[model samples]
Target chain A: MVQEDYILEAEKLYVSYNEIDIVRNVNFRIRKGEFLGIVGESGSGKTTLLRALMMLKRKNNDIKGNVRFQGRELIGLDEESLRRLRGMEISMIPQNAVTAMDGTKTISSLFHETICMHRDGKIRRRDSDKLASQIMEKMRLEDTGRILKAYPFELSGGMCQRVMIAAAMINNPKLMLGDEPTSALDVTSQLQVIQELELLKSNYQVSMIMISHNLGVISRIADTIAIMYGGRFVEYGSHEDIIRHAVHPYTKALLAAVPDADGKISKGLPGLPPTFEKEMKGCPFASRCEYCIPRCRKELPEDVAISLTHRVQCFRTKELQDDIA
Target chain B: MTLLKVENLTKRFKKNGETVTAVNEISFSVEAGECLGIVGESGCGKSTAANLISRLQREDEGNIFFEGRKINGGFRLKPVGRELQMIFQNPQDSFDPRDTVLQGIMQGALSYKVYSNRELKEKALDLFSYVGLKPEYQNKKTSELSGGECQRAAVARALICEPKLLICDEATSALDVLVQAQLIDLLKKLKNDKKMAMIFITHDLPLAAAFCDRIAVMHKGRIIEIGEARKVLKSPEQEETKKLIQAVLPVR
Candidate 1:
């Protein structure tokens, strides 16, 4: 696809704290209406990467890279200019809904504030409420009247999330960033949330970037899968390329570790996840990788395209692929 | 081979002055060295049932038998808590905030008087290895440990008593997939190697299918369907069972 066709594009993106880069040299491009799923465990810097995309870095961290949204550069944009892009153009659904929304305020007020922020005095409370309920109904949330009146804590975890998703749609954002959107839900509720997201993708021309620890969740939702480990994209490919033909040891190990629907389980990837305490070199997964050699520990491997879209960063990916085949 | 059996077990609580039948006439038997999974949504009385079985909360009605001995307020002989231990969903509440994880584990075993204080420390360390925790983590407080690490320590604490029957009340649900996988592998080992029986309670049917020998689907504080895990997964008898099996996002 051409550069203008991409909804969000990142080049050599780095989010650093105390001169220690947490998210290092990240690069990805999402075309319009495409979903990019980032799979990572906790501390993999997936959240940091998402925050950096919108100039929402923590007070101590500095985001260094080039990120273009609809051909408009995001980095170094003043807070006033960035505000215009955020919420209306680029929306986000946070990990925890209850914490993100005001607990004391009813769901309607939260929606009113969000809608009013982007539209200024051009929009009123009634219009925003109508828009919110319309989106909620589209998401198949019943009892809109009761839901709008209910406090954030009064709603269930899944309901709160659905409300957030609905609220995010009020401004009609081109890009939606979800961080572990359905992780807190039970199985049935999770299914509902996933279905709603799928519906949103089909019904609306919106591109999404969701980072979740659940491979199953990502596999079902995303068009492209990025397997992130130690703050780097260890593997990036189309859903088929990553799922059917996984090459990276971390990706394969991650795929193998979880219990399948049949209840089959692997020995699980051993060792604690890497703690990025200092500036270091080599693969982040080398310590836990079963096929790790001495060279693997000392040298950081660059991304090699095993296929047109499937990229892997591992010294032993070739041998691993051979063994798997 | 019946390890623990519950006959018409019922528990009730007054919520806002309204009586709630948390567990209504539940009956089941767990075999020695068997893992029986109780699957249900939140507030379906799975956790309440676990609490009653472990004697954390007394059942309102029905009988509980541990190794064929009827257990009640005056029950003796087997002493439920020692032989029948439980791991909760959040290990944060399971341990002492001030003490080391090793100290918390030793505390569980110290009451039984089977091991010396010095010997219990060594046993705790051994259990840590089994749970994939490093030896150095023994001194760290529960606050210092990660959620997975705290959970592993909780497993060690439960194992310190060397319980025959372990009731995990959505114990792995709070953890991420990789940690859950590792924890399940460790639990499976304990079940096989020590002939331990477990009552695995979780809302996820697919997860239960992976570990449990028998699966029981619960709805409205009652077991709607109970059968072999394979049978329940392949061909569920009840509508509730079908809903649960259908709800899981297809991975394969």
Candidate 2:
């Protein structure tokens, strides 16, 4: 595909906090209406990378790279331009619903504010209530009247999240960024939320970048997967490639650690990710990798393409694939 | 034999001049060395049942028998708290932020005969290793430990009194996958070695399938279905159970 085909693209993006690189040179592209899943352990810089792409970084961090949205340069864009791009063009759904929405405000008022922000007085105050209820009905929320009147704390966690998702879609953005959107919910509620997201993707044709720590969630939702470790994308490939034929040790270990639905427990990976307080050299996963060679500890590996879409950053990825085959 | 029996467990909370039933007439028994998982969504009353059984919250109507003896008021006092321990969803909340790991764990045995400082420290050290932590962690403050370490410390604290029944109220939900697996392994070891009965309350179906011998599916303050874990997951009769099973993203 040509570069113009991708709606969003990040090239050599790096984010540093107090001179410590949290997100290393990472690159990816999201084609129109495509869902890309980013999976990693906590502190793997998945959230940081997402924030950087959206230009939502806190003041303390220094971001270095290029982000293109709809063939336009996004990085180093002025705040006014970035603000115009956010929400109306690129929306976000946060992890915790209870904390994401204001507890003091009712769901209806929250929707009114969001709609008014993007609509720019085109949608009157009276119409917002009708629009909010219509959106709630679309989101499959029952008793829309009662739900709109209820405060975030008064409603259930699942309900609050559905409302949040509805609020994000009020502006009808082309892209959605969800960071652990369903992690706080129960299984049934999680299923409901996931279904709503899938419906939005299929019916509304909304492209999304979902960040999750759970491999199962990523596998179930994402068409393509990016496995991150420490501060880098160790492997990026199609969902089947990552799930059935992952070459990176971190990705392999992650898949192995998930318990089977048949009630069988897999061996847990030992050790934790290296703390990035100091400058990092060599492979970040070398300390925890089971098949680490001496070279892995001494040098950083380059990204090698197994296929057009499948890329791995490991010195021994070929050997690992050969052994697996 | 049943280590704990809960009969007609019911609890109601009165708020804003309206009474809402949290747990309604739920009955179950836990065999020694067995884990019974109560799987449900947030408002399903699973956590309420755990609280009522552990005597953290008073049940409006219920009979809780610990080894054939009924337990009532002042259950948090000696012998009762020691025999029936509960681990919360956020393990850090259960700990006193100002207390050291040794101090927090030794507090679990306060009901028993007074222990010398050295004896308490020795016991705490033993429990540290028992929950897969280094003995040196006993000296660390609760704030210094990571999420997994705090949870291990919480488990050690719960087991310090050598409880007959352990109630884990979504204890592993806040942990990572690897740490959660390690905690499950430790809990399994404790169940096998000590013959301790556990009530594992959680919202994750696949996790319950892996950890529990039997499962009770709860919905809106009712147990919609209860049976062997594998059987329930394989051929769920109740609509709630089917939905929950379908919701689980199958791992292999």
Candidate 3:
């Protein structure tokens, strides 16, 4: 696809804090109205990538490489220009809605802020109120008036999450970034939230980059899947390609970890992920990988293209393929 | 025979002068050596019930019986507290920062005067091993361990008390899927070795179904349904339970 066909693209991006590279040489692209899922464990730099995209990281943090939106480099954008782009061109629905939103502010006021900011200070109270109600209605939120009047603390977690989504999508941004959107919710509420996201993606024609640890959620919604580990993408491809034929050991471990509906427990991977402070000389997963070779422990694996779309960073990719064959 | 029975257990907290019934007249029972799972959403009173059983919180009005003796009927039962212990969700907060894993477990054993100092150390090391932690981890502080290690330490502390009942309140919820599977395996091993009865409280129905012999489904502080884990989860009798089951994505 041409560059213009993609709404967002990250090319060889590197993000670091205090000179420590947290996200190393990441690359991905999100097409128009496509849902991309980034799955990884905690401290895997998934959040860091999203923060970099939103420009929400600390000012002193060093960001290297290119992040383009509609072919425009976003790394050098000024605060004013970035602010103008936010909620109009792109918006983020943060995790932990209870803390992300102001506890004292009503849901309606939060929606008003987004509308006002995105409209370049042109939104009126009457128009904002109508828009908020319409959006809330689209979300199928109950008692819209009461919800608008109630503060974040007054609503349930599920309700607060919906309100956050409404606020984020009120201006109808072209792309939406969700950071562990359903992780904080219960199973039932998680399904509802995922359904709402599907609805928004379809109705609003908005592309999404959903970051989650649950592969099950990714399987349900994501068109593309990127498995991140130790600040790098170990595998990236279509959902079918990655799920059916995961080339990376970390991705295989993740898939095995999920309990089947029959309640049969699978063998879990042993050992913990290496700490970020430790310098990785080879494959980050080599220590815990069952198929680790001596070469895997000493040499970093390069990203090897397997097919037109599938790619993986593993020395044993061919061996795994042959074993499957 | 019922190993433990909860009769109309209720707890209320006054927040801003409004009485919120956290546990609303919920009742359930567990057989000896049975693992009973309590599944619900947050603010649905599963944790409250666990706390009540562990004596971490006193219920407003209810009766909890263990071994045919009443334990939650307004009468003080310090002995019952010794027979039950709780494992919280956040393992780091459950332990003191300055305390090592051995120190934490030894403290639990020492509280009931179960073992001498040297014996406690040995027991702590053994507990660590039982939970799949290395003996070297016994001297490590909470900060030195990962989330899964910290949870193993928490389990060691709870088990060191040698309680007849263990209450795991979302003990594996904060863990990654792989770590969660390991912890569940550890719990299953411990249950088989000790034949210990447990109350596994969580919001994940599938997890509960996997770990518990029976499950109690809670909604709005009420025990909406209770039965064998497979039956209750597979063919829930209550509307709320059915909705919860349907909401979960079917695992492939």
Residues A1-325 of candidate 1: C-alpha lDDT, one tens digit per residue: 3679999999998898887889988889999999999998878899999999989977789998899998889998899989988999999999889899998899999999998888767667787788888989999999998999999999898889999999988889999999899888888888888999998999998999999888888999889999998889999999999889898888877787666767677876777778776767788898888788999888988988898888898998889889879
Root-mean-square deviation per candidate? 2.1, 2.0, 2.3
Residue pairs with clashing backbones, model 2: none
Runs in model 3 deviating more than 4 A are B12-25, B75-77, B98-100, B134-144
lDDT of 1 by residue, B202-230 (tens): 98898898889999999989999999998
Candidate 2 regions with alpha-carbon error over 4 angstroms? B73-76, B111-113
B58 Cα displacement, candidate 3 (Å): 2.5
- How would you encode candidate 2's per-residue C-alpha lDDT over B1-252 as one tens digit per residue? 988888988889988999999899999899988899999978889998988887878888879888888885555545477888989888788899999988998877755756676787788888887888877777789888888788888888888778888999999888777767778888888888998889999888778878799999998898889999999877889988888777877543
- DockQ score of candidate 2? 0.59
**Candidate 1 pairs with clashing backbones:** A263-B210
* Clashing residue pairs in candidate 3 (N, C-alpha, C atoms within 3 angstroms): none
Would candidate 2 be rated incorrect, acceptable, medium or high by CAPRI criteria?
medium
**Poorest 10 consecutive residues of model 2 chain B by lDDT?**
B72-81
Model 2 C-alpha lDDT per residue in residues A43-146, reported as the tens digit of each score: 88989988988998787888998889988998779998888788898999999988988878888889888887766666765688899898878878889999
Instruction: List per-prediction Cα lDDT, in the order shown.
Output: 0.87, 0.85, 0.85
User: List-wise, what DockQ does each model earn?
Assistant: 0.63, 0.59, 0.60
